[model samples]
Target: MAGVSRYLAQSIVGTLRQDPTLNPLATLRAWPNLPAEALKRLNQADLSLVDRALEQGGWIWEPTDYPDNLREMESPPLCLFGRGDASALSTPMVAIVGTRKASSYGLAVAEFFGKGLAEQGFIVLSGGALGIDAQAHKGALAAGGRTVAVMGTGPDVAYPAVHKGMFAQMEASGGARVSPFPFGTPSFPSNFPARNPLIAGLAQAVVLVEAPAQSGALQTVAAALDLGRDVFVVPGPITSPAFRGSHGLIRDGATLVEHPMQVVEALGGGMIQPLPPEEGDDLSETQQAILACLNGGPMLTEAIVRQTGLSAPLVLAELTMMELDGIVKKGRDGYQRGL
Candidate 1:
């Protein structure tokens, strides 16, 4: 099996070099000489160190284990290198992507979506970058849910360095850190555009929290669109440049989403189980009134106040407390019942 795996790896590498745009599996099956030529190249290289590194990092490839969602891509990666529980890939996934220079609003929205989706049994997926990506992963982790980080660098390489701890926690928590790049690959700007598709491909839907007109998150959105994956964009303040790309996407017909459940519903809500009710059966009268106001859908604090005849300050205070207690969630549109 080891020898067969190495031969298969060589064949994929050689085919990629010949035509980077071609599907390697198809090429390998169609051209009999492809494997021989690949093996020849492999003979000339030293792979002992690579094997050692893979073993040390707990990296392995299970070609057959590629997620069904990703396999539908026009050009999915020939193989994936992953550390930790790859089973997480089989779960319903939603990718959250945004600018590395995210604002507080962007970070909060990303985290809220991440946590809410996780609570509903969806695996949150994202690039392992700073700003929004980091916050998304943190939110999922806080919820004690799995989250996969699709990386541009090698599976073993932590690109931002600051996210090294987060990556470690992901692996420990039965989530995965995955990359299609070869071992020892460094973080390069050129690698990220290529990496974006994998992030989009792994998810049933993609969400853009915040992105500038030129943000790399747009690349992922394009890939998602090409693959026919549902694309959702959070509306940002018109004055903020960080949301320019997201607004453009909405204008181009992408679904405009304010709450995470909006995303779940757009993707067909059957995949996720309903979240259990919040603890503490005894609810305050104001809390009951607020919940009553939100029965139709999400409502703003002011709207809830008007319907419940509560003061603005009291409504705001209760909403904040409820959000922390998992009784409610705040989105761009307003406050809604939590998962």
Candidate 2:
């Protein structure tokens, strides 16, 4: 309670009076006087445990240390618990979210955008859920860049449990996992919607990779729009139900992005320019042929092989190398020249 102001303590008491549960935003909204029981409950919280966890895993921060973008939110969290580099929270960020039940195409789009944006010095932010979110985090880590996973549970907890390794890697790579919730909080269904606003608040923009009509990703999009964050959607085939929400977003005026650079350019505020090829970065003959195949636009591996008369395996190998070399990028649609 050291950092808790008199007004905040009063608000917490007020919120508990209405519903025994603590609702941070509601507390901020109604600053009623502290009732005896609520005040006792507030005083009884185990501050020692929170302090030990903060000292052991990471640091705790108030609004002063929060990212300026997040702090501007109408109902920002009073305190944040974070692991890894706290500085990353202040950096320009892009949130990429989609269905937990993502398709291969959706995963690829998430990874492509995740890597592309991170390479340009933007921190990739996501929910750390499976499918698209996991791939997004993987892509940023693969690029040797930073990413921040805004959790729906406690900062110390990896909700799905499968992502504990990822949570460690993020911190090791100078990225972070953050939460507004206290330590030991479980991944309750209610926590996610509450967590969505933080994801939107931390980002300059939000990208919906592939969301179905009833997807949770759409909820994040709503929060992003409410926060005045730019929203971008990756268009998908009309035949696919997975794209229904994204297409609707496009129709409603969210920018449609076929490539990650479009998102970068759209959110421009001194974003780093794409690096020029280094000296002696000349392409081999096969590489040149593959590049030519993609000159028209992004093309599938099979299409590139057919156009360049290269074998399928050879094309795949070459494309993989090119992607690592930053010569080309692979998206849900296919491969295109890197930005």
Best by lDDT: 2
Cα lDDT computed for each candidate against the true fold:
0.80, 0.82
| Candidate 2 residue-wise lDDT at 213 | 97
lDDT, candidate 1, 134-207, per-residue tens: 88898788789899999988777888998989999998988998887766567766678878999988888898
Name model 2 segments beyond 4 Å from true. Answer: 1-10, 13-48, 269-339
Candidate 2, residue 138: the lDDT equals: 92
Clashing pairs in 1: none
Error of 2 at 8 (Å): 8.7
Cα error, residue 219 of model 1, in Å, equals 0.6
State each model's C-alpha RMSD to the native: 9.8, 7.9
Per-residue error for 185 in candidate 1, Å, reads 1.2
Question: What TM-score, to 2 decimals, does candidate 2 have?
Answer: 0.72
